[model samples]
Target chain A: MTTSVNPLWRFRGVAGTAWFAMVYLYLPILILIVLSFNANKVATIWSGFSLQWYSVVLDNPNIMRAAKNSLIIASCATVVSTVFATLAALAMSGPTFRGQSVINAMLGLPLLAPEIVTAVASLLFFLAIGMELGLLSVLVAHVVFCIPFAYMPIRARLEGMDPRYKEAASDLYATPWATFWRITLPLLMPGVVSGAMLAFIISLDDFVITFFVAGAGATTLPVYIFGMIRMGITPEVNAISAMMLLVSILFVILSWLVGRVKQ
Target chain B: MLSASVRRTGLLAPTVITLFVFMVLPMGLMAWMSFLEPGTYGGVQWGHYSAKSYIQFLYEWDLDDQLVLNTDYVGIFLRSFLLAGGATLATLLIGFPTALYIALKDEKARNRWILLISIPFWTNLLVRTFAWMLLLRNGGLAEQFLSSIGLVKEELNILYTPTAVAIGLVYSFLPFMILPIYTSLEKMDWKLVEAAFDLGANRWMAFRRVILPLAMPGIVAGCMLVLIPALGSYFIPELLGGGKSLMIGNLIQNQFGASRNWPFGAALSFALLTVVMVTMIAYNLRFKRAPGADK
Candidate 1:
């Protein structure tokens, strides 16, 4: 512990812990991966080695339907939320407007507060307004939570941005709208992409909020998996979990690489 | 300039209007609904309002003759705090080492380490939660391995405990801790530690005296990122801790769903809001007090 400036002991300690932590963090997924290849309908049983469960999950129309619904919802939520969040980011980061602090807090509060609160609040709001619980309500809920993620990276980019880029565009006789589209959008694309990716993943992973807001007909993938777990489990859930983990790991690497490229 | 600004109603109109309709108004409605009692089937009784539910929360009777009152929401709040605190501590204990190592490593090594960490982060939280269930449940690896090793007198019932909940919560949030710590460690001036070493301090001593102090800001940010959500995470405890686990999140869920007590849930949400606000203000004050915390 006492090799202060040498960098060697620091490296050794850190590397050792990093490996340990990585394995610990990933053990669950590793278990699921091991189970996926196990030839068994029972999650705990190792009947043999087979690709049957993967085929089962792929063949099941209900899971496919739910997953398709989920993809549609996530895409809609991400696109809608990211656009609004970007505009809000632009507005807040621009000239100091009235109620800017309130606006900023409103955007950020969803991120800090638990999904339970947002779910209940949205449920109450929808009820009061007579909106039925369905895919639309789920979309509304996803967009609400996704905004902060989009706003954050975009806002950071905006804050660090030089106003002169827009100014120069204007000086070159570009219309304000044109300048925003041509110059601002392209420059802001990286942050927007990361933020949208974040929004997409959040919408994909969300359960508590989605469970409450999504009604019977609009059951999303996570909710379906949750229902299966509760109603005397299934091994397909494990298979799905393995696939989801793979996708998530891929998405994270992709986002990080994209972020680095922008930098 | 004024005319040009006015012309860009394209931006202002949507921004102002959307925040009001979606963000601000929903919160306001929730606060209002929280003051009213739940109706028979569901929803508010429209005009009725009272402080009764909030008061009752302090003293509700349980299935047992004990004063189980209001599901002891106060206990749930405190337990959540403990859980969050534990997870934050665990994450930092491990994360500090990893981030320090990465920051101190060669650029290529650091990049490789970061990519490895970021991988688990991409999956949705539900997938991550399910992964844990797969690992700890009855038929899963833990029970199988432990039973094989004679670690279990009977079947090990580890799932649905607070320990399981904490594991899932920590697994989900560990990245938040690492990133901030990495940023802080990356920004550190290694020369100070080198100088301290040259002046006769050993490795651990330099790390303790120089690197740790400089890295405190990142640690604090990391803590905030992890702690805030860990306190509020409902799904992890619900799934891993099982149905018996009633964190404040579950309570809130009940209020909106089966319990049909919107008013009490609103009050609970408000309570959470006030706590978060106070903590944030305190955090800002401490940051200001620190000698060069921001810099």
Candidate 2:
């Protein structure tokens, strides 16, 4: 402990800085939430607290449609991404092969590469295949990005698990598939879920790829928010965003709770 | 040997095929497309090829007004990097203490603190960015609260500026930094730490000597994870950036969007990909490592 430095300044400064940073980081979030309840229709001015914005957002058919589209896309993407990721995880950890090095590098590409690159490629791919840019396109595109997130934590979980148990199951008359289906999947559930959750979250928020790959009629929520954004700041955007924040926070909380319960 | 090999291959077949088609093929095609010209109908224009599209962007299309063209791209690229780099540095600085505090604390504290850190990750990035838009805009909370006092007289619009963009980028990406650093810090060897302290090193010295080096891999991983994609972030700068300037992401988007010059955009995309791939290769070279290496 240095006696030369004043304890009071150090103490207050550290606490103050930390508190300020946290507040600064979170303040906009708080403000958005607060304004979402504003009774006034206009965003530039505020009247009073109101739940009308929430109702308006909910009551709007477009919002509901976009929400449904998002939910279906996310769920499908999660399942596909989780399944493929498990395969990739098994590949990366189970055995090495000639293609192993190539797969490893490719597995990380989406994680590291720019969204625009893949977004462009996805658009081109669909075009080349004569597939219309619609729900299916977005679903496949989202899944492509989600696989790496799914692969990572699940791989970690597989690595951390006791191999002897798997071996025991294999020795007992359980087929490799059966052992994996029962023991491996069960033990790896948390990582799989975590990965799925991460994948879902990412798919839900992805705008860049979603923006380019989506057709005009298939406007996802993110694309909707982005399109509306060009019109300048408004309360509807705030109201919609606040609702989205709630949706995301809810998913995050659910995932965390699920993780805790399993633990 | 052959039978076991076949067995392993059978087990891994689906993963190999799925990854090859979706992951490997798309990237391969993109790399291939980079060399070719983008067709008008959004496919690659075959047989009309040169590196002209790429060269044009790097040299700013040989402008009459060099300063103006340079400002448009060179300046914007530099600004974007600076902003992303600044955000990365800040995340590291702030995330280090928070991660250390959590990792060093008791079990209860660790759980609570980590939960707090993670709650924000679930919220949509767009929503999160929008939240900042709400706070930073004119007559918003920050401006109103400040002006209500004597801190600011005229209304200050903090939204749609570089600083606002930085705030959103930093806020969004901070967790990526924290998670890895926390992992590294939590996995630090307790005995080495104690040994450093016992060997007459102070807290700062012990930390510097024993903790920082061990955490370098995670730090490097976290920074790479945060900074690379951030350079191509369209939304953060788009909404917060207010369409004021052109980022590489935005530029790529423009070529693909209204500009209708897919070749030029693809060329730029290749530029970003090349930079990222080279850097990642360099990173892996420096640390051809696995987890728990030091341990």
DockQ of each: 0.50, 0.42
TM of each candidate vs. truth: 0.91, 0.89
Q: Rate the local accuracy (lDDT) of all candidates.
A: 0.79, 0.76
| Shift in Å, residue A77, candidate 2 | 1.3
Worst 10 residues of 2 chain A by lDDT: A1-10
Count clashing residue pairs per candidate.
11, 0
Worst ten-residue run, lDDT, model 2 chain B? B61-70
Alpha-carbon deviation at B89 in model 2, angstroms: 1.8
Can you write out model 2's per-residue Cα lDDT over B1-295, one digit (the tens) per residue?
3575676677566656665676567666666666677676655687777775755554654446452233456676788789889989988887776666566656776677677677776677777787777677888777877887889999787788888888888888887887888788777776776677678887777767777888887888888878987887888888888876547787778877777776677767777888888988998877657555332
Residue pairs with backbone atoms closer than 3 Å in model 2 (clashes) = none
Fnat, 2 decimals, each candidate: 0.55, 0.45
Tens digits of per-residue lDDT for model 1, A45-76:
78888888888999989999999989999999
